[model samples]
Target: MPTDATPRPTIYDVAQRAGVSKSLVSLVLRDAPHVSEARRDAVLAAIDELGYRPSRAASALASQRTRTVGVLIDDFHNPWFVELLAGLRSVLDPAGYTASVADLALETASGRKPVDGFLAQHVDAIVIAADLAPGTLERVGVPIVVAGLRELGARDAGRAVDVVAGDDELGGRLATEHLLRLGHTRVAHLAGHSGPGDARRRGYESAMLAAGLEPITTGGGATTEAAGYSAACALLEAHPHVTGIVAANDVMAVGALAALRERGLSVPADVSVVGHDDSPLAAYRYLALTSVDGHSADVGAAAARALLRRLDSPDAPAHRELLALDLVVRGSTAPPPT
Candidate 1:
């Protein structure tokens, strides 16, 4: 009684092909605990033979759950994001979920909006890897896991959200302490933008104060190389005795290197420098910049796991995960000039 014009293979077709009921096919697709291993294998084999693709939209309409997570990042140009994505994918892909990345190009300022497209797609949850704009969280209906920024409070919709962040303060302390240990008392910090920058700056100041050394800070907005170069110039002019610099991120540290070279200063000879976020570029033989590892990949995985836990129980209490930091000593740091 099958018509030639019948639509593409559905769960019913897969069930018939596998000699099982439609419910069994459904169970197999959902990876339900009740389904036997043999039955699941048979259903999968039948699906492969029939070229049946599960309709995501249809499944969502029936079960009111879309096994997808929305990820919004502040910027994509930074290599740190690539590592973060690797971590996120490792956790989500094995769990039968997909992450839709939405990059808000902060450079243009116009493209700096949250994942409105993903929200329109009705993803099951959202992970924000950057600092969101004011009032953006108010509109989000699904469970949210915020990484990178830690200040997002409960939403107006009464939906609790989880936050994941690196120990940036500790990272800053480590970087400054490294320079201090190398006998550089006149150290300066190239701080990032508002959120993470403030914490790092605080750490730098705390460390400097503990050493009885005056703390100097220059703005390295958004952790960019250009900003680092400009900030380094200002810091050098103001504090000529500064023999050490702690940059908020690797990009800034690289910029500081260029600035120092342009001024006829040799790295680790005239000055020692340290950067945060031990990005891949920092390890290059030419750069060999010492940096603090923010463990961005671990943070991403933690964020995904937290979101999954929330998806399992929407009423679960809010959680906060802070990844540990590590200091990577490299060629960029050395004892101050005697």
Candidate 2:
């Protein structure tokens, strides 16, 4: 009997199986913190078992506001966005706002405007954490918050844009100073093309000069692990005596690691390496990378706050916020071999 007996299960089925009301399940789905842990677990388990998927269409029709925000990320390959998204949802969920994320890298490949999809869905605002090409953000209409230091800026976009980012220059300075304090003077910086990359490079240079040491910077291209490896290879070949390196990000730092090993140098013993982002790769016991924590989550939360404020008062002065950063010393960096 191939009747409608196996009609797709709904939230009602989930609630009944979890032995709870539909409202409780809804609260859990919304990630409301007030839900008790035990009940939340039961609801989630039931959802998994029944394979119940929430209908965003139904959700939008019921809510007064579209309550959807668009988040534009630079690259899906970078893990830095993981923490940023977590911080974003922490505030967004409680406010009944849902996030719709898009990758700029993928969007560009399809030759579509980065925010076109969001506009079609009528998102309330957009968070930009990517470097958009010229005119890509022209007359976007929605409230826009530039979430990180990228090649793209509000002024360049020809629109008033709120900005919330980590002070990347400070992060670079902290990393260099940490290595300098550990008796390493010959330090090199692996460069990239992003806005934060330039700021970090400048910070490294200034720190080197302050100590009467010359700075060597290279690789003004992509910020991927492969680019880092290429830059490190060139740096080591040109200046084999270089004892310390500060890469643009953790992935790049991983690249530097391989370069060092190829040259038969031991981290912190023969050469020290410091990376930015403090990504999961940095924390791996095998890596234990000395890194700079830009407080990405805090930056994301601040950006969300800025977006909310702009939504409330579109004419208010565009907010500019730059959270401070700090260095996390680990086994990857230490005094140069004496």
- For candidate 1, which ten residues in a row score worst on lDDT? 106-115
Tens digit of lDDT per residue, candidate 2, span 286-322? Answer: 9999999978899888888888888888878767899
TM per candidate comes to 0.79, 0.80
As a whole number from 0 to 100, the lDDT of residue 28 in candidate 1 is 81
Candidate 1 vs. true structure, TM-score: 0.79
Question: What value of lDDT does candidate 1 attain over all alpha carbons?
Answer: 0.82
lDDT against the true structure, per candidate, is: 0.82, 0.88
The RMSD of every model to the true structure, in order and in angstroms, is 9.9, 13.1
lDDT of 1 by residue, 65-105 (tens): 66888888767766777777778888999998898887767
Best by lDDT: 2
* lDDT comparing candidate 2 with the true structure: 0.88
Q: After superposing candidate 1, which stretches have Cα over 4 Å from the reference?
A: 1-63, 106-112, 155-158
